[model samples]
Target chain A: MVSRPVGFEQQASSGALGSVDLGPADLVPFDDRGLAYGDGLFETVLLRAGAPVLWEHHRARLALGCDRLGIPFPCQDALDATWQGDPTAELEVLKLILTRGSGGRGYAEPESITPRLLSRRTPFQPVVKRWQEGVRVRLCNLRLGHQPYLAGIKHLNRLENVLARREWRDASIAEGLLADSAGRVVEATSMNVFWQQAGALFTPPLDQCGVAGTLRAALIDQGAVTQAALPLGELSAVDQLWVANSVQGVWPVTTLFSTNGSRLQRWPLPASDPLQCLAHPLLGFA
Target chain B: MVSRPVGFEQQASSGALGSVDLGPADLVPFDDRGLAYGDGLFETVLLRAGAPVLWEHHRARLALGCDRLGIPFPCQDALDATWQGDPTAELEVLKLILTRGSGGRGYAEPESITPRLLSRRTPFQPVVKRWQEGVRVRLCNLRLGHQPYLAGIKHLNRLENVLARREWRDASIAEGLLADSAGRVVEATSMNVFWQQAGALFTPPLDQCGVAGTLRAALIDQGAVTQAALPLGELSAVDQLWVANSVQGVWPVTTLFSTNGSRLQRWPLPASDPLQCLAHPLLGFA
Candidate 1:
C-alpha cells in the first residue's frame, strides 16, 4: 500500500503502489491510455465528512470493473490514502479514475501495465429539491448500441451517452431516457430508471445494457426495487417512476414519453423512504 | 489554420486552437468529458516517411466524425505537424483525438464550446508479412450492439472491442471479427472485412454498425470493392477474402473461426500479379 503525500510533488515523487499521482505532464503527453483505447474504469463517489461514502462498495465495483476490462486492481489501502488525505475537503465529490496507462498505438495492449490512478475532490452540490419538485425528462432519440458484454459497467466507453445527451438542448428536462435496438427501455443517460407498478418497484435489468448503478443495486438489495426485463410498451403502464444513481440518490419522475409520441403521466413514490434516509446521511453538503 | 508547434511543450500549452501533445493532463480538463461522457472522435493515420499515408481522406473522415458526434472541427495546421519533426521515423502511427472539453456532472453539454484537440506520433510497425502470407481470424461471440447514430465513425466508445479481444489469448489470430445481434457479420475489431464472390468484391456496409474505414472507403472509390449487406451464412460461398484498414493495409484471410463451434475453411487469394496492380501501394507493403 502506498502512503498519502502531503503535497503534489510528494505524491508525484512517490514510487509507492497506488498513491502515485498522474501529473498534468503525464496526462497530456503524446498518448494517454484513457484517450488511446478507452482502456480504463472510473467511479464517481459521493463523499461525506472528508471521506468517501460507501467507499468499500465503490472500491469493490472498481475492482469488478477492472476484472471485466482485464486491468490490475491495486491495494485498497493505497487507494484509500490517495483520496482520504485532503483535510481541507470536508463535504465533496471524489472521482477515482483507474486507467491502463499509456503507450500502445492500436488495439493492442501493453505487456506490462502501469495503471494511472487519479483521486480528486470536487465541490458537492445536491439537487435534492429537484427530486421533491420533480424534474422533467424527455425520450432521447438516440438509442444505445446493444453490446451485451459492455452493458452494465462504468467504463470509459461513454460515447453512447454523449450522443444521446447531444440530441436535446432543453434545460427544462433534467434527464433523457434511452432504449436499445429492440426498443427496450434501458436507462437514463446518467441514472438508472425504476417504475412503481402494482405496488412493486421495478427497474430495467442491466444484463443486456445500461450501467449497473450502485444506488440501484442497493435499492434492489433492500427490497425497495426489483429488476425486470422491461419493454418500451411496459413503460406506459407504470404508476410511479424514479431514477436512481450514486450522485443524485433518487429522483421522482413526473412525466415520460412513449415511442408513439404520447406522454405517460407518472405517479409519485410510495411511503417507503429508504433512499431519502440513505441520502440524508451520505449527502456531502448535509 | 493554426500554426504548427516547434515542439511538444508549445503544443501542449495551446488549448483548443492547436493540437495538444496528449500526455496526462488536459489544458481544460476532459476528465468529465471522456469519462462521464464519450464525447470524442479519433483517427489513426499510418505515417510512412514524415507524412501521414492519407491526409485528405483522414481529414474528411475526421470532419465527418466530428459532425456526427456534434463536436467542432479541430484546427488542421496543428494536426499537420503531428508527423513533421520526426525525420528518422521510418513508419509512424498518428492518433488524432477531438473532444468536447469538461463540464459539470450532467448529460447536458456546455454551449459555446472550445473542443479539445490532441495529436500524437508513435512508432508504427505493421504485420506486413501477415497481409502477404494470409492471417487467421476468429469470430467473436460478443455481438455488436446496433446504434445507427454511432454506427460508422471511430468514436471513443469501444468497450465492445476490449471485451471481444479479451475472449482470446492465442497470439496466432490476427483479429476478431464481430457480428451484430442479428447474426450478420459486421467487421473486424480494428479493420473492415471484404469478400469476393463470383468475381465481385463486397465489403460490409457501415450504415448500421462498424467503423467507416478510410482504407475501405478508398478501396470502394478505387473500384476494388463494393458495399453489401452481408449475412454470416454466406461465408462458405466467398471465393477470396481480405481485411483492410489504414494501419494494417490489407490482410488476406486464410482462416476464420466462430466462437459458437463453427469453423471456416481457408481460401487463398488470386495467385497472380493482377492483385498487386489493384492493391494500394501503402497496402502492398510486404
Candidate 2:
C-alpha cells in the first residue's frame, strides 16, 4: 500500500464544448462557476498501492451528479487523463472537479458549456490513530437545509457543511454529526455514518439532504447496509457506530457526544478491532 | 449614458493568502474548497461610468457573507485591484469571488484560510427593450430550497438557481420566477422581484429563500418597499410587477407566464410611462 503525507499538485484543461482554452493552466479561474456558485461536482478517492481505490464508484457518482446538475459532464476519457502521474507515489490522494467552466454573471447555464476538468494529486493521509483507537464525534448545532432537488449527489454547494463544521473546533472531536432541518441525523461533516445494531448496518437516507457517499452507496448496494432516518435522541440504541469515506476508510467511534460534550453513547471495542474482520480490505486494515 | 454589447474577459491572481504564488500559472488548485465544496462567496455589480454602481452596498453584502461563511475576506484595497483595465468601455460588469482558498478535502474549515479574491470584467449589456417596454417572465417549475442559515447572504451554492433557470428556454421570455419549496414566491432567476399594490411597494421576504438583492435592500432601507410572504396564486392582485438587480437596474414586467406557457397577468404601459416619478434614477429610465 502507498504511504505519504498529503502534498497537492494541480492541472486544469477545457473539455466537451471546446470554448475554453485552458492551455495547461495548473490553476482554476477564481471565477469558475464552481467557486462563484458552487456550480460543480467532485470526487476524492484514495490511491492505494499506486492505484485509485474505487475509481468506478467515483465515476458513477460523478455521472449521477452531472445528470442531476444538468452539466454536460466530463466523460471517462477526460477523467482518465486526470489520473496522470508516476505510479511510484505509493499512496496519494486524487481529486477531480468538473465545473461548468466559466459562465456569465448569473445562475443560468451557459449556452455552450466547456466542462472544466480539474484534477490534482496529494500525499495520502490516513487518520491512523482514530482508525485504530476509535474517534469521538459530537453533534453540531448547525442544521442541514432540506433540498430534495439538490440532495444526494456530491455537488459543490457545500456552505452548509462548512457552517456546520465551524460549530466546533476541538481537534479531539474527530468529526461532527449534522442533522437535517427536520431533526433527522444525517452524517458526519465529511463522511457517511452507519450504525450497527445486532450486527446489521443502518445508515441515514440522504433524500432530504446529505451527500450520497460512494462508499455508502457501495455498502448499501452490496446489502451491507440499510437506510434509516436515525434521530439525535436514539444514539444509545446502537450496538456500534462508524463513519467512513473513500480516502480515510471506515473509522469506528469510541463515543458519540451531544452538542454540550455530554456522552450520548459508547461503543467500546473488544480487545480486537471491529472492522478488521468486517470491512473490505480496501476499507480497513487487512 | 453608456451602452454596449455584453462581452466577458477574465484574469485571476493570488490573494491575501500569500501561500499561493500565482503567476502566469493563472489557475487555482483543484483542492480549492471553493470548487471542492463551493466554500466561497461572490458579488456581481454594475459598472456605470467605470465605477461599481452600488459600491458600498456590494462591499457590505460581501462582508456580511464573509462573516457568515467565516472566510477571512479581502479588504477594500484587494477588491480595488480586481477592477483593473479600461475606463473607456461604455459599460462593463465586474464579478468578485472570495473563496476559502485551497484546503484538504471535505467540509471542515481549513486550519489556515487564505481567502482568494478573484475578479473579472464583462461588457455591460443592458436589457434596453425590456427597460423601455417591460419584459415577459415565466414561472419556473423548479422550486428553491429553504435554508434559513444561508438565506439573505449572497454566498456561493446556487445550484437551485441554475436548475430553475433551465426550466424555460424560450428566448422571448426575459426571466423566470422561482418560489421556495413551501410555495412562497421568492424571486426571478437572477433578480429580486417586487410588486406594487395600492401605491405601495411589496416584495417577498428572503428569510426562507432568495437572494437579498442590493437594489432591493436599497429600496427597502430607503422606505420604498415592504416585505411580504407572497404566495404564487396572488400575482394578479398586484397593481404592477417589476424585477430588479444591480447590473440591470430594474425592468417592469409587462407579462408573467406560467410554466406551461399560460399567461398569468399583464401590465400594459401607459402613454406616459408609469414609475417615471416612482423609481430612483439608479433603478430605471425616467
Candidate 3:
C-alpha cells in the first residue's frame, strides 16, 4: 500500500533521509513494536561533508543490537546505499531505527516479519566549548537497573537515560553521571564515561548496565582504555573524567557535584589530550 | 497530515484504534519521544459491547504513569470522549498509547508537548480452557534488574518483558515467570502473579520491579490480596498459583516448571474456585 517517492530528496524531509535508495518518508505504522514495546534498535552516525564518519562501528553496533533484539536487519544493499547517501549538509547526524515491523497484543514475535527501517538526518554541531573548557557533571538520583541481557546494547528502551537526563536541566552542565543501585558507576546519560588515573585509562564496565557506546568500544579495541567496576564514592579519587560519544568525540568533565550540591570534585585540564588518537579521527575535534 | 476515517474498522489497521470518536488516524510524528526513547506509557482495556470495562482503573494507572514520566495528561474532555467513544464492536480490546509528542534530542523534555494518543481495537478471545484448567508456566532464565523509581508503572520501556517472552515459543505455555537477580519473583511476562497459601492471598511485591496490573490493583483495592516478597524457589511450596489481568481476569496454574523443564510443581483444578468473586464477572467462564 506504499507508493515510492520520486528521487533523492532535496533535504532530509524533516527527519527522513530523503526518498533515495533508503526509501521515502513513511509514517511509522501505528502498531510498530518499536513504538509499542521499544522492541527495536537504533544507531546514530555522525555525518561530515555528506559522508558518514565511523560508519563501520555504527553499522556493527546496529547489527549487534538487531541480533540481540531478534529484529531483522535491512539488506546489505539498503544499508550500504543509506550510509553512502549524501545528507545534503556539511555536518549532520543520521539516525537509523530498526523495528520488528508490527504485531498484535502478545509479546511473542510473529513467525516472520518484514523489518521496518526508518532513517532520518539532523544537523550536527560539534561542542568546542565543552571539549575545550570542560563541562560540569552531576550524579543523578535515578539509578541504572542492572539487566545483563540488555546491557551494552543500544536498543531503543532508553527510559532510564531519559529519566537520568531529566534529573538535571542546566544546559551549562554538559553531562550527568549515573550509577547502579549499589553505588557503582555505570556511565553518563547519553554518553559513556571514562577516567584516567595514574596514566591508565578506565571506563565503567557495562556488563551489568549502561550503553557500550560506539566510541567507548572503539577506544577500548584500540587499547586506549579498559573497563572496570568503578564505585561512585571513589570518583573523587580519580585524576580526570571524560564522556565520549560518536556525535561529540569527547567532553572532559571539569567539575562533579551531587544532587544536593554537597559532594564535589574537580579536575584541571591535562597537560595534553589523552583521547587525541583514540576518538573518531574523522570528528576532527581540536 | 491524515484524513479522518469514518465508521468502525472491521480489522485493526495494524495499530489504528479505528476512526470512531477518538478522531482521525494520524501518523506518528518522526520525532516522537515514544519511538525515540520509549518515553511514554500505555494501557490496554477490554471492551464489551463497545463500552470500556474497568475504565477507571486503566485511566487512573495511565495518569499515575504520566505523572511519574512528567508528561502532561490529555485534557479531561479529550480523555472522556476517547474513553466513552464507541468502537462499534461487541467484544474488543482497546489499546491506548500515550507518548510525549515530539522532541528535538537528548533526554530533557521539550518544555511543552501536546501528548499524542493512539488507540486501536482488536478482537477479544477469552481463554476459557485455561481459566477452567490451570495452564503450564515456566521460569525464565532472564532475571529482572531492580529499579525502584521505575517499578510498578506500565511504562513503554518493556524490552525486559519482550526478552522474557522470547524464552519460549510453545503455544502451550500460557506465561513465563520473571524474577529479580536476588531470586525474588517479580511477575509474569505480562500478567501479575498471585498465590494462595494458608488461606491468604499474596502477590509479589512490586517495590523493586514489575508492572502493577489493573485488575491486580482492583483486587487489592477490594481486599482480595496483599503484597509480599516471593522467591522463585519458594513458589513450589504454595498450595495454588494464579495469574491475572483485566483482559483474561485470571489464569490458574496446573503445572509450573523451570526453563529447562527440570523443576516442576502441579496443582489440580480444586473443589471450588478461589477467584470466582475476584475475576471480572463478564468473562463468564463455565
Candidate 4:
C-alpha cells in the first residue's frame, strides 16, 4: 500500500515538455480567463493503481465542453503523457482543469488562444460506508437555472452547485438534491441522481441543466437507466433512489429530508440493489 | 497625458497591509475557488482622476453579491485604502475580483475563508464614436439561463456572456444582445440595455436572469428608467435603444441585426437623443 498522507494533494501544469510539478506557492496567472470569468471545464476521475477510471467519458465531456464554449480541445497524446501519477497508489483522485488561458481582460476571447491544462491528485477516501449503509440526503432550496447551452458539461461556472452544497451543514445529510427553476428534480449537488420505478431506472433529463456525470452516462449507455423529467412531486412515487459520480461510485439514499429538516421519505437498506450490483464491479467496490 | 501603452495592464493583490504590485508573470493560486467554481464576484469601474466613478454603487453591489453567496465581505476601509490608482492618468479602468480564495479541491468553501481581492488596471478606451453615432448590434444565438437565485448579481459564472460576445467578430458590430431561454430580451453581452417607448424609458427586469448593472440601477433609482419585461417581439416597436455599463458609459443602438447578419430594424441617429442627452453628463461624454 502507498504510504501517502490521507489528504495529501499534489498539482501540476502541462506544457510542451509534459507535466511539471507545481510548487505549493505556484499560482494561476492573474489574467487566466478561468479566474476572471470561470471560462473553463474540469473533470474529477477515480484513479486505481494510478490509472484513471472512466477517462474516455471524462475526455469526451471535456471535448464537448470545449466545442460548446469555443475553447480548443487539448491533444489526447499530450494529456495522456501529462496525466501520469504515482504508480504505487492503490486508489487516488485526479482532477483535470482546462481553461481558456489568459485573455488579458474582458469577455471577448483573445484573437489567438492557448488553452491551459492543470491537474491535481489526492488520496481517495472511498465512500464504502455510505454505499453499504445507504446515505441520507436533503432537497436544496436553491433551484438551478436552466441554460441548455451550459447544461450537462462539468464547467467551472459552478456557483449554483456551491450554493446548493452550502444549504446544509448537517453531517448526517450526505448530499443535497437540486431542482430546476420549474420544479423538476435535476441532480444532487455533486452527483447525478437515479430512481427505480416498477423495475425500471430513470434519471432526470439534463438537456436544460445539471452535469451529465460520467458514471451516469455509462449507466445510460448500458441501457440500465433512462432519462426522464422527474419532477419534485413525482420523486415520492419512485421505489429506490441512488446518486452516482465518477469518483464516489454509487450511493443509495435511505432517507430524504426537506431543507427545514422535516423528513420527506425513508427507505430500508435492501439486502440487494440492482444499481449497487451493476456499479460495484465497475467501481471496484468489494 | 500619461504615456502608458494603449493596452498596458497592471495587477495587484490586497492583504492586511495594502496592495502589492503583482508582476505580469505572477499567477493566482491553482487551488483558488474562483478558478475552481467561479465562486466570486467582480466589478469593473471607470476610474477618473484616480477615483472610481460610482464607487458606492459598485461596493453596494459587491456587498450584495458577497451576502447572497455567503462569502464574507472584506473590510471596506482596506478596499478604500488599496484602491489608490495613478492620479496622473485622466481616465483608467479598474477591474476588481473578489474570490473565495484557495479551498484546496472541492466546492465546499473552507471554514476559515480568506477572500482574495485581485485588482487589475488598464487604460480606458472611450467609445465616444459609438456614443455619438449610434452603434450596430446583433441578436446572439445563445440564450441566457433563467435562475432567480443567480440573477441580478454579477458573479463569475459569465460563460453565457462570453459565449454571446464570441458569437460575432465583426468590427462594426459593436455588441450582441442576449435573450433568456424563453425569448425575453435580457441585456447585451456586457452592458445593460434600455429603450424608449412612447417617451418613457424601459429596461428588462433582471429578477429572473441577467446582471443588474450598476448604471442601470442608478438610472432606475433616479426614475429615468423603469424595470419592465422587454420581449424579443417588442424590440422592433421601440423608438430608440441604448446599452450602458460602468466602464463604457453608453452607446445608442442605431441598428439591430439577426444572428445571420440580416438587418431586423434600423433607426435614425437623432441629433440629440434623450438617452444620450441624459447619460452624457453622467458618463462624461462630451
How do the predictions measure up, each by TM-score?
Answer: 0.87, 0.88, 0.92, 0.92
Give lDDT: candidate 4, residue B115.
77
The chain B TM-scores of all candidates, as shown, are: 0.87, 0.88, 0.89, 0.90
User: When superposed on Cα atoms, how far off is each prediction in RMSD?
Assistant: 4.6, 6.4, 4.3, 5.7
Candidate number achieving the greatest DockQ relative to the actual structure: 4
- How would you order the candidates by DockQ, starting with the best? 4, 3, 2, 1
What is each predicted model's overall lDDT from 0 to 1?
Answer: 0.69, 0.74, 0.77, 0.80
Per-candidate clashes, comma-separated: 15, 7, 2, 2
lDDT of 4 by residue, A104-164 (tens): 3379999888777777667777868988898999999999988888999999999999998
**Regarding DockQ, does 1 or 4 come out ahead?**
4
Ten contiguous residues with the weakest lDDT in model 2 chain A: A1-10
Worst 10 residues of 1 chain A by lDDT: A7-16
Report the backbone clash tally of model 1: 15
lDDT of 2 at A264: 83
DockQ of each: 0.49, 0.63, 0.70, 0.71
> Model 2 over residues B98-152: C-alpha lDDT tens digits?
7777765367766777676666666776767777888989999888887888888
Candidate 4 vs. true structure, TM-score = 0.92
Model 4 misplacement above 4 A: A1-26, B1-26
lDDT for model 2 comes to: 0.74
Residue B121 local lDDT, model 2: 65
- The reply for model 3, stretches above 4 Å from the true place, is A1-26, A280-282, B1-26, B282-286
**Candidate 1 lDDT, tens digit per residue, B31-133?**
5475445567788888777677877888888888888887777665556655556444677777777677566445567765656666556676777587568
- On a 0 to 1 DockQ scale, where is model 4? 0.71
Give per-residue CA lDDT, model 2, range A61-111, as digits (tens): 888898988787564456665664454466777767778778664777778
Q: Ten consecutive residues with minimal summed lDDT in candidate 4 chain B? A: B1-10
lDDT of 3 by residue, A34-96 (tens): 888888888888888767777788878888888887766666655544446545677888877
